[model samples]
Target chain A: EAGVAQSPRYKIIEKRQSVAFWCNPISGHATLYWYQQILGQGPKLLIQFQNNGVVDDSQLPKDRFSAERLKGVDSTLKIQPAKLEDSAVYLCASSLGGVRGTSNYGYTFGSGTRLTVV
Target chain B: AQSVSQHNHHVILSEAASLELGCNYSYGGTVNLFWYVQYPGQHLQLLLKYFSGDPLVKGIKGFEAEFIKSKFSFNLRKPSVQWSDTAEYFCAVKAYNTDKLIFGTGTRLQVFP
Candidate 1:
C-alpha cells in the first residue's frame, strides 16, 4: 500500500507570513489527520477529517490554523500569520476508520513537512 | 479531555539488551491503544495495537505491549534489542467511539552494537 504522502519536505518562512502544507492519503482511507510536532515534543493532533467532513478540530488553533479535505481525498493545512511557535514538523496520517473490531486502530503516517518560521 | 503519558524521554542500550517503555492514558471512557515507531529518516509506522480480547499484544520486530486497565497503562517491551531498533516510539490513545487520537511525548531509544 502506498503510504500517506506529504509535499515540500522542508519549508522556511518569516514570522507573520503564511504557509500551507499538502497531504495525499493512501487510497481508500476514510480518515485523515493533521498533527504538529514541536522539537523535543510529541506530535499533537491538530485536526481530523472523516471523508470530506471534519471529525475533530478541538486542538486546532482556529485563529491561525486551518485545514481542509476536498472531495474526500487530498487535504491541506495552512497557518496564517505564522508564529515562531509554529515552526515544527507537520505530519499527515490516514486510517481505515472502521469499527474498532475491524481496523484495530492502525494508522499510516507520512514522512512529514518540516517548517521553520524565522 | 484525554491525554497520553510516556515515562521515558530517552533510552540507550547495547545490543541484546532488554527494553521496556511505559505509556499511560487518562480517559474515563473505553479506550484503544497503539504504539508507533519512526526509524531515522522514516515515516511513523504502527508497531502494535490493543483493542480487545488480549492484554498482551504482539507487534512487528518482536515488540509487545501489555495493556493493564487497572493501571491505565500500556507498556511496550522487547526481550533483546538490536542496533536497528534505534528510533522514536510514540504511544497513542483513542477513546472508544471517537475518531481522534491523543499521543504521548515520544521515547527515543538508541541501541548500540
Candidate 2:
C-alpha cells in the first residue's frame, strides 16, 4: 500500500510571499492532519480533518494560515504573506478514523514539504 | 494544558551501544503516550505506544518504552542499537479522552560505526 504523499518536497519563498503545500493521504483514511516542524523540533499540530469537516484547528494562525480538505482525500495548507518564522517542514498525516481500542491507531505521515522563508 | 519535553537534545554513541531517551509530560488527567522515529530524509513513524495495561510496551525494530504514569514519563530504550537506529526521536502525548497529540522537541541520536 502507498503511504501518505506530499507534493513540492521543498519550497523557497520570501517573507510576505504566499506558499502552499499539498497532501494526498492513504486510501480509505478518514482523518487527516497538518503539522509544522521547525528545525530541531518535533512536529506541531496545526489542524485536523475528519472526513470533509475540520476536527481541530486551535493552533492554526487564522490571519495567515488556512487549510482545506475538499473531498476528504486530499488536503492543502496555505500560508499567505509568509513570515520568516514560518520557515519549517510542513508535514501531512492520515489515520483510520474512529477510536482504537486504546488510543487512535497510529498515524502515517508524509515525507513533508520543507519550506524556507527568506 | 498538556505539554511534552525531551530531556536530551542530541546524543552520540558507537554502534551496538545501548540507547535510552527520556520523555516527560505534564498533564493532570490521564494520558496516552507515544514514541516516534524519523530517519534521515524520512517521515515520522510510530516506534511504540502506551495506552493502558502493561506499563512496558515493545515496538518494531527492537524498540521499547516504559510508561510511568505516576511520574508522567515515557522513555524509549534499546539494549543494542545499530547504525541504522540513528534518527530523531519524538515523544508525544494526548489526554485520556482526546485524540489530539502534543509533541516534544525531538532527541537526535547519532550512531557512529
Candidate 3:
C-alpha cells in the first residue's frame, strides 16, 4: 500500500516571504492531519480534516498559517510572512477512519517537508 | 489539556544490550497510547499501540511497551537490540474520546556493534 506523500522535501525561504507545503495522503483514508515538528521537539498538531471539512484546527495560527483539503484526498498547508520560528518539518498523516479510537488504526505519515526560514 | 513526556533525550547502548525508555502522561482520563519509531532518513512508523483491554502491547521489530495506569506511564522496552535498532522513538497519547494526539519530545537511541 502507498503511504502519505509530501513534496519539496526541503525548502528555504526568507523571513516575510511565503511558503507552501503539499501532501497526498493514502487512498481510502478519511482522516488527514498536518503537524509541525521543530528541531528536537515532537510533532505538534496544526490541523485535521475529516473528509473535506476540518475536524480540528485549534492550534493553527490563523494569522499566518492555513491549510485545506479540498477533495479530501490531498492537502496543502501554507504560511505567509514566514518568520524564523516557522522553520520546522511539516508532516502529513492519514488514517483509515475519523472516529476517535473506535477503530484500531494508526496514522501513516509522509516523509515531511523541512522548511528553513532565514 | 493532555501532554506526554519522555524522560530520556538520548541513549547509547552496545548491540545485544537491553533497552528501556520511559514515558509519562498528564491526562487523567482514559487514553490510547502509542510508540513510534523513525529510522535515519525515514518517516515515523508505528511501533506499537495500546487501545484498551491489555496493558502490554507488542509491535514490529521486537519492540514492546507496558502501560501502567497507576503510574501514568508507558515505557518501551526490548530484551536485546541490534545496531539497526538505532533510531528516534516517540511516545504519544490521545484521549479516548478525541482524535487529537499529544506527543512526547522523543528519545534518540544509538546502538553500537
Best by the lDDT measure = 3
- C-alpha lDDT (0 to 100) for residue A114 of candidate 3: 94
Clashing pairs in 2: none
Q: In model 2, what lDDT does residue A103 have?
A: 36
lDDT of 1 by residue, A1-118 (tens): 6889999899999999999999999999989999999988889999989899998898899999999999999999999999999999999999888553354558889999999999
User: Sorted by DockQ, highest first, which candidate order results?
Assistant: 3, 1, 2
List model 2 lDDT by residue over B15-92, tens digit each.
989999999999998788899999999999999988789999999999999998788899999999999998999999
Give stretches of model 2 more than 4 Å off.
A99-103
Return the lDDT, model 2, position A24.
97
lDDT of 3 at B81: 98
Q: Count the backbone clashes (under 3 Å) in each candidate.
A: 0, 0, 0
lDDT (10s digit) by residue, model 2, range A1-118: 9999999999999999999999999999988999999998888999989888998999999999999999888999999989999999999998886553243678889999999999
Candidate 1 vs. true structure, TM-score: 0.96
- Please give the C-alpha DockQ score of model 3: 0.76
- The TM-score measured for candidate 2 stands at 0.95
- All candidates: DockQ: 0.63, 0.61, 0.76
Candidate 1, which segments miss by more than 4 Å at Cα? A98-103
- Backbone clash pairs for candidate 3 read none
Over the true interface, candidate 3 deviates by an RMSD, in Å, of 1.3
Q: State interface RMSD in Å for all models.
A: 2.2, 2.4, 1.3
